[model samples]
Target: MKILLLTPQFPYPPHQGTTLRNFNLIKGLARRHRLRLFSLLAPGDAPAGTPVTDLVEHLVTAEQPRRSMARRLRDLVSTPLPDMALRLWDPRNFDTLLEHCRAHPPDVLQIEAIEMAPYLFGLLAAGVRPPRIVYDAHNAETLLQRRAFLADVRRPRRWVGAVYSAIQTLKLRRYERRLLRSVDAAAAVSEADAAELRSMAPDLPLAIVPNGVDLSAYDPRHPYPNPYGRSGPNLVFTGKMDFRPNVDAALWFADRVLPLLHASNLGPHFWIVGKSPHPRLRRLRNRPDITITGAVPDIQPYLAHADLFVAPLLAGGGTRLKILEAMAMQKPVVSTRLGADGFPVQDGVQLALADTPARFAARCLELLQHPERAAELARRGHAFVTAHYGWEKIIPGLETLYSSNDTLTGASDRR
Candidate 1:
């Protein structure tokens, strides 16, 4: 099959869950099918490689609009809809896609996120030969914003954020409705998400195509000691720190959970690892125990060395790949219900589930104190991920989806 894979981020250097899953699928799919990728990125950023160009037929790159107050206000005032306005500046990317389609249309067009859906709207509007527009929903992104709004945000700004979320959700839902009616099929990272989408658009063709981790790269055989390891117990939270969900999670953990454990003086050190540390997260460095490593070449060694992997994330949608990778490396994990939101694992079996600050702290302390129990949790986690969530087993479902509707043509004619 000839596939046109569109994504907001380069899937390589797969440190985060979305990147890892998308990267692995693309790498695997590329091996079997002819792929031409039209991927997006944040401004001034590029995926480090010739692998994309060398392996895939072609790679189209564009910068996402900068999210600033000026841009936001301009977007709100300029367009009738705030959500479309925010993503409207990327006309160049759409033009790029149209040009690619004109020259080499694909057999299937798999868009990786809701933000990229708008680009397809105009193309479809112009009566471009309907391609199999598969929305590879990495997360129910609007739901995450809705949850953030439900939380204690500031007074005046809270309403603004809420309005923004409502607008975004409506736009995405409208696009989803139309795509469901016109496109071949759609997929979500979990059954819970698939069910929600189906309920909203019952006639929509959807399936539970989950996120998978490449066990080969994230191996336990080559474990590295905690780079942030000091003389105490190291608790690591890895994700894109600049992301609102991750930022909120780290702050909540540093403010609520870490303080509870500070009393024991068992040297509770928190390492916030990933790319693009936000200003809010950077402030966390003020504390003696919290260290933020902006971006590392690799996370496996850190995962191998950490006493326990902690995910106190309270906001965000979709299954967490960091938690899965940690488990794949045979490390003990302590997460909030929100952190372990979509996974099929049980408490005290594959992972420890703790929501409140006190409970989360106690769980971590218990793991740190009991080596045998912690080791057992680690072993169970590894077994659980290997049995169900490995990429080799999970990606065939996606291939099936792409192949199911052969009538759905892509931007290329190779298929």
Candidate 2:
């Protein structure tokens, strides 16, 4: 099959969850299908001569549009479309996509996330005949916004953010409904996400294709230098630090849970490793116990040296690829129940689970003190991810969706 994949960012390095899913899917599908990618390039992204270029038949990119805070505020009142719908809105990308379709039409148009949904909607609005379109729901956007609103409304300081999310939640529901209804089929990252999308468009054909890790790249046996040279039981939590949920999780853990660990006389060090550290996280630099490394060349070394991987996420939708990467590296994890939502692992068997700050601190302290117990959980966690969450295992489900005759024929009905 000839497939055209559209992404909100260049997926070469696969540093974060969205890119990890997009890059791996492209790699897997390239084995049997002719794949082409149309991506938006963020300011710092350099994609030329990357491995991703070798995976696809052709690649095209456009500058990701930037909207000022003033413009976004204007949009909140001026347009009914959600913030995501306008995030990557650019005429150049739409024109590029149309040019490619005319020259080398694909059998399927696979969009990565809701941020890229604008291009699909554009093609339809232009009255161009589209191929079988598959809307990949990285997160059930509406549900994600609703969760954000609920989480933020509880904190008096976050009322402004809560109000913003409340508006996006309503707008996203309407946008996602139209997107799902217009596409021939949709793919979801988890059963939890699939259920949410199903509620929006019950008749929409949806498939569950959970996010996965590249097993070879995340091998536990590979030796790495300890990124934290002077560390004493380094607790690591990694993600795009600028992301709302990650910023909130990092702050919550440092402010609420870290104090408890210190009081327990553990003398533990916390490492927040990832790109784009939010300005809000800067206050954590005052403590000598915390290290915030922004945009490291690689994350595996940090995970390799971690005494325990801690995910104190209070709010987010979709399964975390960072957790899968840590598990594949054979690291013991302690996360909130919500952090481990979509995975099917037992609390004490694969890793520890705790929701409250006190419980989370206790769990981390226990794992750090007992190497033998942590090793057992690490072994089980690695085995679980190897068996179920590898890209090789997850790609076949998507392949099945691509080959289905019903999906190909259903495009006409949506049109």
Candidate 3:
């Protein structure tokens, strides 16, 4: 099969969630298919050469114009499309796709998310007779936006953000309802997202292509020393710090939850790891217990050595890939029920689940006090992912969808 893949970002360095999925999927599909990647690069992003050169037949990158609040506001006021959709749709990207197709038309066109849908919209408007199109949904953007808006109710000061999220959600949901109906097929990162898409377009062919981890890359056997040499119990949360959900998670963990731990006579050090620390996250700098590592070359040392991996994500969608990677490393994870959404795991069997700051704090203390129980949970999580969520196992079903012409009756999962 000749596959043309479009993504919202360059999938190299595979550190963040969506990029991690894209990089691995591209790598897996390339070996069997004639694959080409058309990815977006931000103004300052270093177009790292050939991370996929070993896998892909051709690679083209479209530079997304730098973000401007003014431009976004103008688009919101002027256009009917969602601001995010408008922000990502660059006609030049379609021109690049068009140039390639004119020479060698692809067998399949797989779009990464609703963010990339406008490019396809643009192509269809141009009267292009493209091949079968697949919408690879990272998350139900409409649901994610609604969740984000509701989360702001807790932070009354962020009312503006709450309002903005409401507007975005309304626009995006309407746009997605119309757009998804046009696609030949769709693949979601989790069941939660698939459910939303199915409700919008019942006849749209959907597949649950869950997120996965590279087991060899996250081997538990690799000896990693505690980079943060503190006597207190250390908790780690890793993601792109500049991202809104991650920034919110780090702040909520530190401001609301860490105090609960401190009041109970337990000393805890929270390590917020990953690149591009948002300026707001810098505020956590004053709190001695928190250490925000802006960008780290590697996270294995932290994951291997931390007393616990905590994901207190209140808002966002899709199953967390970081959680799977930590599980592969044989680390105990404590996440909000929302944090562990869409993945199959028993609460106590695989990892601890907690929601409130007080409840979340108690669970952290329990893990710190009962090392044996934490280790048992870690063992189970590792075994579960090893058996189910490895990249090789997850990608084959997705490949089948790309190759088969048979009509899919409804959304399907490999398991």
Give the winner by TM-score.
Answer: 2
Candidate 2, residues 1-415, lDDT tens digits: the string is: 8899999999978888888889999989889899999999999889888999889999988899889999999999999999999999899879998898778878989989999888988888887655688888899999889989999999999999999999999999999998998888888877688889999988877777788899999988898988898857889999999999999999999999999999878788999999999999999999988999999988999998889999999889988998999999999999998889778778999989999999999898888888999999999999988888888777766765665464422111211
> All candidates' lDDT scores?
0.76, 0.88, 0.84
Give the TM-scores of the predictions, in the order they appear.
Answer: 0.90, 0.96, 0.95
Model 1 CA deviation exceeding 4 Å by range: 43-49, 77-85, 153-172, 223-226, 404-415
lDDT of 3: 0.84
Ranking by lDDT: 2, 3, 1
| Candidate 3: 10-residue stretch with minimal lDDT | 406-415
lDDT of 3 by residue, 1-415 (tens): 8888888888877888878999999987877889888888865556556568668888878887565888888877677778778878766677987777677677888988778888888777777656688888888999898899999866889788898888889999999887788778888777889889888998777778889898888999987776997875888999999878888999999988999888767688899999899998877888899999877878888898888999999999988998998999999999999899988888899999999999999898888888999999899999988988988888876765664573442223444
Residue by residue across 119-159, what tens digits does model 1's lDDT show? 77767875665456677777765465556566534436457
Regions of model 3 farther than 4 Å from truth: 43-49, 403-414
Q: How many residue pairs clash in each candidate?
A: 9, 0, 0
Clashing pairs in 2: none
